[model samples]
Target: MPTTRLSKVFPEELSEDTIHIIVQRPPRDLEFMPKNKRIRITEGWKPYKASNGKSVDLPPSWIGFLESAELEPDPRKAFDYLKNDLQAGDAINIPSMGQVPKDFGIHDQNHKVFVTEQMLELWEDMRGDKD
Candidate 1:
């Protein structure tokens, strides 16, 4: 079965300033505790940002969050945030957000980014849902 993959997604409607990156809390792995007994750090995507400036740190599984984004002031700080306070910052969710495709075709270097009609529609509704 051929599944749709999106390497990078930049909804045409959302400008560069929108905080669209969705990050979840880092998981805890402990030898003392069984995998099932281990605490679930986060159940859903946390309203996290990579930098205070708009983007957020995401794992390789979610690396395809953004297709093309201009870097903010400091690149180093953003990396540190990933290590330290990824989900520690914002703890809210932007409604109207749907999961972007995760299977970003690892075999291909030229990552193909697909912005579907549904994605656009989902993003378009974000503003209305914002409290």
Candidate 2:
């Protein structure tokens, strides 16, 4: 009998089943835990003025909340609250919030949680359902 060569078939992309498994896994709670110190403005820091002539201060207790509250890992949600709820103006608070330190930069002044591209990629990798 003559022998015939078998053609090889390759997948164009990863299988949807594999992708679903990777994305459907529950997100780690530690991944979403806030890992930064919160700061609240005191009375002495109240009525602080921004370069734009807008007041940019928080109540002492609220400052305490900012400086102490557990932050959400999702930068979008965090920023949304910061912009809408905190209203720290575009100066001190905004800048500080937007530029959280490397150890605490999970959120941004834009109130974006996990705003970095890498973070988004991680989110997709862990939650993508496209299969």
Task: Please report the candidate that would top TM-score against the real structure.
Answer: 1
Q: What C-alpha RMSD separates each model from the true structure?
A: 24.6, 21.2
Tens-digit per-residue lDDT, 67-102, candidate 2: 554652445554443323222222323223333456
- In angstroms, the error of model 2 at 129 is 0.8
Model 2: residue 122 alpha-carbon error in angstroms: 0.7
Q: Any runs in candidate 1 off by more than 4 Å, and if so which? A: 1-103, 109-111, 129-131
For candidate 2, the 10 contiguous residues with the lowest summed lDDT are 1-10
Cα distance off (Å), candidate 2, residue 38: 30
Winning model by lDDT: 2
- Candidate 1, residues 1-131, lDDT tens digits: the string is 22222224433455555455554455654655665444333223334455456755444324434433432134443334222222223322222123434664465623334445565556557538656
Error of 2 at 111 (Å): 4.3
Give candidate 2 regions above 4 Å deviation.
Answer: 1-114
